[model samples]
Target: MNLYPVLQTADVAASARFYRVHFGFAPTFEADWYVSLRHPLAPHAEIALLDSEHPSIPDGYRERARGTLVNIEVDDVDALATRLDAAGVPVVQALRSEAFGQRHVIVRDPGGVLVDVITEIPPSAEYVAAFAPNE
Candidate 1:
């Protein structure tokens, strides 16, 4: 299965700029109130920047901080996090092995979106043996 992530931004224009300048992602779709951006390399990704001014935005969620908290799989989460942290990017989390066979970390973008950087790990023999215990 494929995965996608979306987040509500306090200001659509401001968020769009961050994606455009920092990530070089441009708008695939835009309106007076909303904009959806896509990375040139990741054409399938559709990260929609929700407008706070939009009529449908819930009041409660509006006050809550807007963050992505999205887990994006990479080749090496440790190296990626180090490079990002060295570049002055604040890492909300750190790389560590997870039960899902991955090491991951978190990033909070300018739009208040939290992105989780992940790298898949090979399944452990013990884990593979668990389901096949009877074998």
Candidate 2:
């Protein structure tokens, strides 16, 4: 089964552009109050942006702020980070490599949702050795 995360944003178009310009997501469906995007390479990975003030949103949801994050796994974290930087997107967390074999960066979309853009990389020898089965 595929999972889709829906974000409530003040501006649906701006939020949609944030994903499209930075990550190359295309709109599968769009309206004045909502938009659904499909990942460029992984169709199963999807995101939806909805107007915070739209009637479809549950009552009182519009009054609360969005505090959740959306994680996107890509093939090249650095490349995507560069593109986002060139486009003037603000990075909340600098690109860094982790011991868990992931290179990632954190940025806030226009909707104020934190998005973690990540890609897998070769793990450090120490990390691998630590997890290696006892010889």
Candidate 3:
């Protein structure tokens, strides 16, 4: 199954640009009320932006997303963090290594989505036992 997130935002174009600039996504489709983006090297990685008030969305569910965090795995979280900092992107969570084997940073997108950029790292000794046997 193919799964991708469709963000409902007030400004679809601005939201699309934010992903393109910060996450290396290129637009596959674009319209005033919607846009679809895919990573050039990873076409399976996709995201869509839609006008929050689009008629197709049920009225009750058309509101902007809240309490949602999108995780995007990358090869180098530290380098991305530095680039984002240089570009003045707001970092909600500073770059840090987690005991569960992740080096990551959290940033808020223009549409208020929390994007957790991450890289896999060796798990801390103390946390290694928490993983399932196969893992």
Top-TM-score candidate index = 3
Which scores better on lDDT, 1 or 2? Answer: 2
Query: Candidates 1 and 3: which is better by lDDT?
Result: 3
| Per-residue lDDT of candidate 1, residues 1-135 (tens digit) | 745455666777876776665455779888757788877774455577776656687666554245337656666677777877876767777667876467888877766777787887765666765453445
Error of 3 at 47 (Å): 0.7
Please report, as a residue range, the 10-residue window in candidate 2 with the lowest summed lDDT.
57-66
Superposition error at 7 for model 3 (Å) = 1.0
How accurate locally, in lDDT, is each candidate?
0.68, 0.85, 0.90
lDDT for model 1, please. Answer: 0.68
> Clashing residue pairs in candidate 1, if any?
67-113, 68-113, 68-114, 69-114
Q: What local lDDT score does residue 26 receive in model 3, on the 0 to 100 scale?
A: 92
lDDT of 1 at 67: 31
Tens digit per residue, CA lDDT, model 2, 1-135: 777888888989999998887777899999999999997683557889888999877786784236797888888889889988888888999999998778999998888898998997878876786565659
In the range 42-101, model 3's lDDT, one tens digit per residue, is 446999999999999997898887898989999999999999989888899999999899
Model 1 misplacement above 4 A: 1-5, 17-24, 58-61, 64-68, 129-135
Put the candidates in lDDT order, highest first: 3, 2, 1
For model 2, how big is the CA root-mean-square deviation? 3.6
